[model samples]
Target: MQTRETFAGLSDWQVGLWYALVAVSVAIFVWGALRLVLKYRRGRGAFPTDNLFRRVARTAWIVLTHTWIRRRDGVAGLAHALIFYGFVVLFIGTAILAFQDDFAEPVLGWDFWRGPFYLGYSLFLDVFGAGLIVGLLIMATKRARNPARLDYGRVDGVGSRYERWRYTVGDWAFVGSLLFLGVTGFLLEALRIAETDPSFERWAPFGWIAGQGLQAIGVDGETAASAHFGGWWVHGVAALAFVAAIPFTKAVHMLAAPASVATRNDAARNRLVGLPPNPVPEEIGYGVVADLTPAHLLQLDACTKCGKCHVACPAAASGYPLSPRDLVLDLREQAEGTFGVRASLGVEPLFGSDANLLGNPIRPETVWSCMSCMACVEICPVGIEHVPI
Candidate 1:
């Protein structure tokens, strides 16, 4: 006989509410994403679209394998890989469940949430969810233990902007969201197991353990059912909020990073692309955010702020005012206008300041500090080219 769980004990009204929340979340995400696209479109130059097939294949390989990240820091890279893959698998599992609930059971009159296949899926998700939590914990611990590890070295003359402070709020928020998702997910599963008292509880080993704990505390079926419904709503809303927040936050790097890698220059690594013959003198190097190409703007958005570029930079290590990560962040601030009052007004000339990048945000000394060694470029896992920029 097949078991019927009523999809985590949600009522018809609750289901409708969940769908409404999802719609709103998706709309917010789409609007934010479109705004970002328009910002990129405002950039100066065109992106190369040559070698279509090659680009696609390269992007897939880099994103899937995370080869660039793995090449630099093995332990951190492995943790990142685990977190990434775990999230992917969990997302896929959620999609499958949605398909089963909304389409398969109603329209097709079929359900796959039974027998060996369902058991395997449950076990897989359980294991990966735990792995994801562990990976996040490791990253958080590293950040806490040695904050200077992110700095690489200190800047001599510059103040707070060049100095590596603690992790930003965005960093904490991103990590916190993931941790909440993982924990709440397992809690929801445990509640479900307690409510349903499934014979196949053994298949979901983690959930089963949680359910046994709840039972030891004398949680009745009625309480378990109520808790399951509450958890369902909380987890669902949190998941949707996290998705909606992506385009507006540093989390967008999840998409931008691989893209920066895949669409990176195909020519010689160190060789700089020469300017067009008889070009205007003013068109030499990037002076401001407006001078950059759309692809360059996208690269700016793609930065993970890992500070590996700063670490590898000879200039930064030598106590010069320039940190490659700081340069990128400054440019990004100008591009996005996340800091100033002009941003809230939705005014033109993104930076809104008459002074060029050379004075305030980036000093002449800082620009001169660069040795053109390509050390930052070579070490950047996301393929950011600080020297060229």
Candidate 2:
């Protein structure tokens, strides 16, 4: 009696249609992810497997604890932790619901999503849902204030100036989308509670309170039902679209960041990577995109454009052209154009096979500007190996 109705008012055909859309979303996600993997594989050296298990465990600990994210700005670190954990809990909640509907009750005949379990689940999700919104607000506010770190202005000014603004738009759109999803999620829950006004629904504290407000405003009965129906579709579609777009968008950091952290040489600053037994002139340093190691390629995507590296870089501080942040970004643009999804789409600044990174976009002057200072490597939250690159 205390459980939710899966797919509530939808007919059999509509439910089937929803599943079809989910399939399309998942297929696109997988394809985009595979494309990224291939793009990384196009690089020179292989992904490191040395001490992988220990490295992975360490990565998980670091990522879960948000240790790297919180280093310079405690507020941003807290905000990120809130968003990360909230999304995780909400994701698990959705999975649990799906498993019960699609497998447990129907196939195993063990329906456990009721009573105490349902109550606890509702309360957990409600709290995290609110947390997600709060975290997004803090981030949006930080961006609005135009802090020095978050500022995307170009000091080197190699590529199109509009490129930086496009990145700005993408960052805002990312935050906006997550914010929109969080708000609509609560609204959906509120609408549902207002429609039925069930006593058990009090477990979802935020939704319950919002539902009461809706009822106070005379949004109940048929009006609530109509709104819920429309909203369910809206939220469902947006959620699916967000999932499918993750790998193709800035959200790729969700995957790339973890991999970058895991693969990063913990002692890189102290013991720089040794040169080849006898290096050729062509192999002295990376001249082209293909010469970048797989870890470097992955690091390019792992960058959140946080600018911590830029701030910490001595080269940048001295007004040199070498912003480690900009270097990675330029490499990223080149990598994407050469081998990644942007190449497939024929986006501007497209690179051909063996495209010379040092030729354009990345200037030889910028490379020379670096003093091999390890500040960028040390301060990078996502584990980009700036000194090595």
Candidate 3:
């Protein structure tokens, strides 16, 4: 029988410190997330409220099946689905461990990490961890091999210098953090097995292999223990940091994407909602980020910058100035206050005589290039309405 330990060899104070760090991280995440929510509320648009249960069911199905993604790119969709399911399982496993260590054993005088349950849990995590790794590698390789393939020719001349830099940096940071989290998780597992010499180590196939490799390299008991401790702290800190950064990074898509999918207007897929007959024409279309409705602004945050929209965009394929992906990124940068002078206050106007999106970030030619074909809208995994926007 395998036994689990709570906080392992850490002192009470050290454990308390960990909890404190988690609390602080959670608070920061909440504050940032709330700011985003409040900002969205400042915009003017209404989402559908009918068919609540149906919407929830549909959203769940879409996420589970990767339906929209698979519609066009089957292999990439499969890779993403693997990563998503693996992450979900690993998250549930983490919750279970937390419950067992913090509440179950201490309050209920019971533990679940033993015998059949322990073996099953260990095996599941090991298998899923490998899956997550493979998925990440596939995505990373695709991005590296065809970095420019997603560019809609707009990013080259559009947006402020700061905006461009921020997008580039944020993209790398998001990918690097996820990769770090996945890799370090497996390393910590391998180190733990090596240090403890667990009888059930073989059940954790990947960890067992890693442990054997480390052993073959002459990693002794004391060295393994030290490395395990270091890896544990590194993994824990990285996880907490990732959580804290979610509201400010591309990871916000994880929450916003599902909501976007659930709230999408199925009736308006092919048809652009006609403006009220003979409406006053102050701004014929979106001139800036500020011109977008609340729902549209929220959709910007939901975008994963996956470039599926770009790939599907007719204008982009024709070598036009309009890349739906670039258009979204430009608006997203302004929404997040990454451009222009008022960026520090997070209230920067996206368009002006000098900073107009129509002729500046997005050229007049780009605005006219949109055929309103809805290809981008139909293929967007997050349900972003590029045609409508």
Candidate 4:
């Protein structure tokens, strides 16, 4: 490995490009985070905590223990954690790569940091990537069989084809992207070792497999090197694209989840309690009627559409007119639908005269069908707390 410090190891173009990417990612992350935090605090007026420490302790317990979601989602919960935590670990790995490219390599004069760091990293990648891959496979299989076995065909109230299709495509895209990223990373490592550094072969099992395959191809040293670099490009590009796509894709929840956890209300986990009273005389509703706030829209976007909520929804199982998944999906649709209306008709607040807590346009059965069991709330990985309408 080259003993080159930081971005100095990278050519000027590579360094500049990496810097730009990291800058954009950080900027977007910060903006979204600040907006969510501010909105949450503003929406829930500040007050002195009576059991500040205890409340925090309980929140920690709830999140770390995952007592609620685990109980409601069961295997689906475990699968979600595998994917969620795997991505978390993957993020750390990516950060390390960034530091190596941007800081460590330049500062430490070493491209490859051996010993404990590298070993631990390799182990993390193998385990977490395996977990993500396995979890996704289970999820995909479940999606395929869930509809048929759950008798969706007979259930007239099941979610629409468009919603199902969106979910399936989103899930597959995320899975495929992650898989390709991991696989190509290993391939790059293997090629690097076979061509330039055989020592890495001992610590990198995945890479060794790729290197062996390269040797089988009977390519010359130059060809192998080119192929290896090409693979690295593919891996890096996929990773970059995944990052860019986050705010615009279902994967956005990966980032929103922590914030959701921090701000989520346990009591409201399974209901849509009316929004706090709008003190304005002209105010029309309690919750969103039209022109939902950015934060509300964020929550809608954070939905993974995994149907864990649907599984727990009494309405879904009882042949009623409500499914929690469909509810959120409908809210999203309403928001989108109102986008045009908002500009012309002005925002219609959903409280006061306009308020219909019993589900108004959404249907009364849909509102009452919720058991308020908080099962849907408990099961949502993103901490979407739905309560009585």
In model 1, which runs have C-alpha deviations exceeding 4 angstroms? Answer: 1-6, 151-156, 160-167, 338-350, 353-355
TM-score of each model, in listed order: 0.91, 0.98, 0.90, 0.73
Backbone atom clashes (below 3 Å) for every candidate: 0, 0, 0, 17
Give the winner by TM-score: 2 or 3.
2
In the range 1-389, model 3's lDDT, one tens digit per residue, is 68556566688898999999999999988877777777676554556788999999999999998998788778788888778888888989999998988899889999778888988998999899788878878777776675564332353355444344556567668777888888898887777777777877788999888988787897748888799777788899989998898887878888789988887878546799777567666445665556666677788889987788787777777877778888887677666663222353546444342245565455677778899889889888888888778
lDDT of 2 by residue, 1-389 (tens): 89888788899999999999999999999999999999999988799999978998999999999999999989999999999989999999999999999999999999999999999999999999999999999999999998776777777766564368877888898899999999999999999999989999999999999999999999998899899989999999999999999988988999999999999988776666888988888777888889998988999999999889889988888888778888888889889989899998888868877777775777778888988768888888899998888
- Rank list by TM-score: 2, 1, 3, 4
TM-score winner between candidates 1 and 4: 1
Compute the lDDT of residue 91 as modeled in candidate 3. Answer: 89
The digit string of per-residue lDDT tens for model 1 on 108-186 reads 9998877777888888999899889888888777666756536434464656554434336677788889989999999
Model 4: per-residue Cα lDDT over 1-389, one tens digit each: 42213222246797678668767766765554554444334322342245556656765676565564566457766776777677778788778877786687788887665566676677677678668767766666666675632222323343343235655667678777876776676666666656654554455566556677777777536776777656665676577777766654567676655445555555575345554565663243335433343444556656767666777767677787667776776665454334322222344422232333235336666776666777777667666655532
Task: Please tell me which predicted candidate would have the highest lDDT against the true structure.
Answer: 2
Highest TM-score scorer:
2
Model 4 TM-score relative to the real fold: 0.73
Off by over 4 Å in 3: 151-165, 276-291, 338-357
lDDT of each: 0.78, 0.89, 0.77, 0.59
TM-score of 3: 0.90
Off by over 4 Å in 4: 1-11, 21-69, 72-74, 104-112, 146-164, 269-287, 290-299, 336-361, 371-373
In model 3, the Cα lDDT at residue 230 comes to 78
